[model samples]
Target: MAKITYIQTDGTSTIVDVKDGDSVMRGAKLNGVPGIVAECGGGASCGTCHVYVDKDNTRPLSTMHAVEDELLYCTASPRLDNSRLSCQIPVSDDVDGLVVHVPEKQI
Candidate 1:
């Protein structure tokens, strides 16, 4: 299992152990971490599961893909360079300490 942290807009943080191959969206939903609606499940079609890869800790994350990049434009929140769809990020041992920041809202 890989441990990941989800930081909310208000600065609250939730740390949970995520199973390998599970998307970050699943991790947040299963752990009851707020801000990830996952409207389309882990399909990467919904921007509702939007999150920002913590600039300080992205060693465990994969490079953004074209599909994910296209979907991010649909978010209600202001997308940043670090913005990513949680559903597009899978948990793995290498990303055990991954940290993501939740936006204030999702469209």
Candidate 2:
């Protein structure tokens, strides 16, 4: 299981043990991590699951695809270099201790 951390806007963090092959959005929603509004589920159709990949882990995360980039650009929050749609990140054993910071808002 991978240890995933979701940091909320109010400074509360929800840490969950994500199983391999699970998406970050699925893990967050299952663990009741607030601020993660996966409107389109894990389809990558909505950017509600936007997260900032910690600098240290950015390189290890999956590379952004064209669809993911489009979704990120459509998000209501300001996009960062490390911005990523959590749905695209599959939770696997290799991603243990992954930490993602949720944005202040998501539309």
Candidate 3:
């Protein structure tokens, strides 16, 4: 399991043990972590699961796919260099201790 931290807009933090191969969005939903809406259920369709990966994190995430790249533009929050769809991030030892910041809104 990978330990992923989700930081909310109000400065709240939630740490969850996400099973390997599960998307970060799935982890948040399973653990009842606030902020991740996941309206598309990890289908990479809706951008409700958008998150900002910690810029200082050393772990490298998977390359963004074309679909995810396009969807990021539709997120409620302003897209940043670190913006990513939580559904596109799979949990594993490679990304253990990953920290993501949740935007203020997801609608």
Candidate 4:
């Protein structure tokens, strides 16, 4: 399992262990991490699953499909450069220490 950390806008942090092949949204839902709505359930149709990933600048995120990028524009909150849909991010051993910042609002 990968240890994923979710940081809220208020600075509250939640850490959950998610098995490989599952999405970060799934981890939040399963572990009750707040601030992730996941309205589309990983479909990348709705943008409520948005999160700001804190990763090394030199390492680019993997598997960010065009649909995720398109849906990000529909988020209730303004998108940031590190913005990403949690559903689009799969949990894996490589991302064991993945840190994501949850926005203040998700609709």
Candidate 5:
């Protein structure tokens, strides 16, 4: 299981254990992390499950899919090099201890 952390705009934080094959968005929403809206339910349609991955961890994740790239570019928040739509991030045993920091908002 991957250990993911979400930091809300209010400064509160939630930590969840994600099983392999589970998307980060699913893990967060299932665990009740506050800031991830996940409006499109992992379809890459809505940009609501946006998140800024911790810079250090960005290198290991798979390359961004085309749809993910577009959604990230159109998010309400400014895109960072580490920015990603959480729904597109699949958890894995390799990412077991992975940690993600949520941004201030998702709109």
Candidate 6:
């Protein structure tokens, strides 16, 4: 299991143990982390599961696919260099200490 931290807009932090191969969105949804809406259920179709990857993380995430890249443009929060769809980020040992900040809105 990989330990992932989700920081809410209000500065609340939730740490969850996400199973390997599960998307980061899956970990939030399963643990009731109050940020990801996941309207498309990790299909990478909706941008509700958007997150900002902490710049301090040392590991590099997988390359974004075309669909996920396009969808990032539609997220409620302004997109940033670190913006990413949680559904597209799979949890693994490489990202054991991953920290993501949840935006204020997901609509």
The model with the greatest TM-score is 3
Instruction: Please tell me which model should have the higher lDDT, number 2 or number 3.
Output: 3
Model 2 stretches astray by more than 4 angstroms: none
Candidate 5 wrong stretches, greater than 4 Å:
none
Q: Which stretches of candidate 4 lie over 4 Å from their true place?
A: 55-60
Tell me the tens digit of each residue's lDDT in model 2 across 1-107: 79999887677888999888899999999988988899998998989999988778843667789999998988888999989999999987778888889998997
CA lDDT, every model vs. true structure: 0.90, 0.88, 0.94, 0.87, 0.82, 0.93
Off by over 4 Å in 3: none
Estimate the TM-score for candidate 1. Answer: 0.95
Q: Which sequence of candidate numbers ranks them by lDDT, best first?
A: 3, 6, 1, 2, 4, 5
Over 2-79, each residue of candidate 3 has an lDDT whose tens digit, in order, gives: 999999988999999999999999999999998899997889999999999998989979999999999999899989
Model 1 segments beyond 4 Å from truth?
none
Tens-digit lDDT string for candidate 5 (1-107): 78887777666778789988999999999998887899989998998899988766743676698999988888887888888898988988766666677777789
The lDDT of model 6 is 0.93
Of the pair 2 and 4, which is ahead by TM-score?
2
| lDDT of residue 85 for candidate 4 | 97
Task: Report the C-alpha lDDT of model 4 over 35-87, residue by residue, as the tens digit.
Answer: 99998788888899899988563333567789988988879889888999999
**Candidate 6 least-lDDT 10 residues:** 54-63
- Ten consecutive residues with minimal summed lDDT in candidate 1? 56-65
Predicted candidate 3, C-alpha RMSD: 0.6
| Residue pairs with backbone overlap in model 6 | none
Compose the digit string of candidate 6's lDDT tens values, residues 56-90. 87886888999999988988988999999999999
